[model samples]
Target: MSKIVLARVDSRLIHGQVVTKWLQQSAANEIIVVSDELEQDEFLQSIYLMAAPPGVEVIIKGTESVKAYWENEAAAKNSKVLFLVPDLTTLREMVEAGVVKEAIQVGGLGGGPSRKNVVKNINLSEDDVEILEGLLAKNMEVYFQAIPEETPVPIHKLIEKYKTL
Candidate 1:
């Protein structure tokens, strides 16, 4: 059966860090990017598909489609899947749909007017914090770590620091 070795949330979906570090670390042969917007753009979809390393397979699907895939075909394949979601909102929705049930790796969150920088490449809005906390409440291991080398900051620590900021 296919298994999701890594479930990560990164604003920049298929980037260098993902191709170089996380993919190798997770030992995932297939990348399943769950994004509603990206699924609609065939041009961008092609670009993302081409961005992956030669042997690795990349498939872009919308939230609902991914959930269905996980429930059906995903269980039959021998592939090790690397699940990627673009934002905390999508991450939360996927979890609620039962697509992602365990640990999460937060790589990058773009900075915005209402968002605060929680780490060098990580930013968080109020809603983002709430979504993460909700995941933690469900006993999900949520963490912020840029690469496999960087120390992973736990959800509780980030929430504690965000309150102080």
Candidate 2:
């Protein structure tokens, strides 16, 4: 059975921190990117593939395709699996689609005009917070941390701190 080592939602699909920090901490051999855009864009998929270290296979699958892939031989062969999406809504969708429940470790969510509610480094929109709340209600752990060793800031407490706004 494949174990979900890391479930992350980042605006930047993949980057240096993901390559060095997360890959090392999770000891993940394969990085599975679940995105509809990446699935259709062969060029972007190639870019992500080239960016990753040699021997670390990068599999790009559509968000809706995750469930089938999860039960496939390839996913079963891997010991460590990292699930990544661009936003919280995608994570919630994946969970709703029956991806195994696990704690979601949030990383860098880049700054933007609409994303004004900043907690630690993750900028949460109202919809993002709602998705997180849904996940938390499902008993899925949600927290923020740029790196694995950093202190985890729980999403629930942060939401409580700023829910009225």
Candidate 3:
């Protein structure tokens, strides 16, 4: 089976930090982005492909299809994969599907009316917190670590900080 090097929840799926920091840090050769929206948009998919580094392969798939992709023998035997999902809901779905077995790294969620800043470059809404808390309850390691060099902040601590706000 293919080893999942990192499963990251970053709203900006494939970007500078991911390409320059996380990819290099994790030594991931393939980036698998799971997003239903992106799967239907060839333009955006092309853009994401163009953004990735020369040697790294980028595959965009919908949430439902990821389970099958995960089970594919060719994918499993090929290379280390860095899985990226846009939000907590997608992460929850993947985890529930048995696709993500490792610790989940929270990169960035961005700011919104219902969302609160948990750490620098990281934000979460009430729904996001609930999903993450559910994952934590299931004994999954979910933490915030934007880049490779920074220490990971536990999800509960961020929730506690969010509650105080």
Candidate 4:
């Protein structure tokens, strides 16, 4: 069985921070990106797949496909893998599917209408707050931590600040 070293939500999925910082910090040898949209675009998939460091495997799959991959132990021989998703919606789907059930890292989200800058690099809209609150209700450990060096802001604190905005 594959162990999820970390599950992160970052809009810029395979950026510098993720490739250099989080990957080494988590000691994850494989990066499994779950995105329904990316699976349909081979060009984008190729870009992300090649972003990982040498020897670090990168597999792109959709929400449903990832679940199937998770179930099939033989699909990936690597033990520790990092799961990266683009947004809260996809994270919610993975969590509901029983694929991700532990700590969730909110890394980075770009600014948009109604999107409040909750943390250094993380921005959350009203819908994002609602989703985070729901996840918290389910006893999930969701937090905003851009990199491993910084202290992670808990979901409760993040939601409180979002409400104030």
Give the winner by TM-score: 1
Give the distance in Å from residue 118's predicted Cα in candidate 4 to where it truly belongs.
1.8
Against the reference, the lDDT scores of all candidates come to 0.90, 0.79, 0.90, 0.88
Native-referenced Cα lDDT, model 3: 0.90
lDDT of 4 by residue, 36-146 (tens): 999999999888888888998888999888898898952457568889999999999999988998799998878998799877777888888888988998989998888
Over 21-79, each residue of candidate 3 has an lDDT whose tens digit, in order, gives: 99999999999999999999999999999999999989899998878888884254768
List ranges where model 2 is wrong by over 4 Å.
none
Of models 1 and 4, which has the larger TM-score? 1
Instruction: Rank candidates by lDDT, best first.
Output: 3, 1, 4, 2
RMSDs, each prediction? 0.9, 1.8, 1.2, 1.4
What is the Cα-based lDDT of residue 68 in candidate 2?
A: 86
Error of 1 at 19 (Å): 0.3
Sort by TM-score, best first: 1, 3, 4, 2
RMSD after Cα superposition, model 1: 0.9
Decoy 2 TM-score against native: 0.90
Number of clashing residue pairs in every model? 0, 0, 1, 0
Candidate 1 lDDT over 1-165, as tens digits, reads: 788899999999999999999999999999999999999999999999989999998989998888888888888788988999999999999989977876899989999988988778888899998998888889999988899998888977887888889
